[model samples]
Target chain A: GAGVSQTPSNKVTEKGKYVELRCDPISGHTALYWYRQSLGQGPEFLIYFQGTGAADDSGLPNDRFFAVRPEGSVSTLKIQRTERGDSAVYLCASSLQGHNEQFFGPGTRLTVL
Target chain B: AQSVTQPDIHITVSEGASLELRCNYSYGATPYLFWYVQSPGQGLQLLLKYFSGDTLVQGIKGFEAEFKRSQSSFNLRKPSVHWSDAAEYFCAVGVSGLWNKLVFGAGTILRVKS
Candidate 1:
């Protein structure tokens, strides 16, 4: 029905400012993903899409990061100067394009103070 | 350098007993295993996957996994365990066509003693 969805579940910027994290992929899902979880560590990969382009952003770790889904469902993920190490928690996933068994969403906990 | 090795970071078991969680991976060819389960804010929840014939895979709720290619491994099991099943248990390794990254590990909390 409706699964993958991410908004501002939680965010607190301050370091340098500039943040945008959004994702809503599920309906028909053309493949999309973005992961990052610090704290104890686990999720890591950081960019991927299959419909509006961005097949992969090579784990975007530097360059301030950037993401866009154009018209392939919905995706935002954009960070410019924010850094406290960029905080953590920022996941989004979707699948059904071949195999990957993805389907996650309920993240967006960035806090850079 | 694909990798994933969750050699237990925490494990308590005792809500009903019987449970194993260990995974190891080093991709280079056939490998797409998975097993996710987070509950502390919630998000990932796919309990099982093995992308091939029957290497013993059964996900969701009861949970089950066993895809041992010699020694690469793919543990995760469950026989009872119920205190709401504790939480945090991840071990992934997926990378299919197009650039679908997913190499995860460093997880495995599950602590349900009582």
Candidate 2:
């Protein structure tokens, strides 16, 4: 893809339901990241992947939030037992390498009702 | 741990006026600093970055940021503001070492008045 792309531009889920957001990074990019942006706030880091494996998951918030990038290109963020507080924009970004400039996707606006 | 702080939550400026946005960060070593802008319903776009060398770094959209090591500040400045510059701005700090995550500030919203 020419830029980072995210699926389901908007998602609305009920409490206790599970939701999945997908992200497809730029071609040949080796670093991918997931971030969550709440209303009136900047995007918060959730996880980072250097390749097929997650290099940092410290920012996942809790056990309910998980992400995977099995092929280092496409990534998925899964939230289990979603709550109303989970409503926010889920953003995906990719960089040619770590600590470099990141190109962001359009983002998935997740609303948990 | 590294963290960024953008003190002003919101700023209103008239078009063609000069603008400055303050940013401060807490980090142990040399910091990789960045400024990003986000328009309504859009993702963030990098405005400028400061890796090393000169204290002043130039970025896109006629924006520039100066890194003050002693002050722990990386303030963004523009000589003239445009109506198109109305957006949310974020300051981020990355570790100097290889392959580290970026810690971002809460963000500052800019409103341009015609």
Error (Å) of candidate 2 at residue A74 is 0.8
Candidate 1 residues A5-89, lDDT tens each?
A: 8998999989999999999988988988899999998999988888888877889988889999999899999999898988999
lDDT of 1 by residue, B1-114 (tens): 888989889999899998999999888778888888999988988888887899999988988999989998999999999999899998988865123788899898989989
Q: Best-fitting candidate, measured by lDDT?
A: 2
In model 2, which runs have C-alpha deviations exceeding 4 angstroms? B96-99
**Which residue runs does candidate 1 get wrong by more than 4 Å?**
A1-14, A17-35, A39-42, A47-58, A65-80, A89-112, B1-12, B20-31, B35-51, B57-75, B78-88, B97-100, B103-108, B112-114
Clashing pairs in 2: none
Candidate 1 CAPRI-style tier: acceptable
Give every prediction's interface RMSD.
7.8, 1.9
lDDT digits (tens) for residues B1-114 of candidate 2: 778999999999999999999999999888889999998777789999888899999999999999999999999999999999999999999854443577889999999999
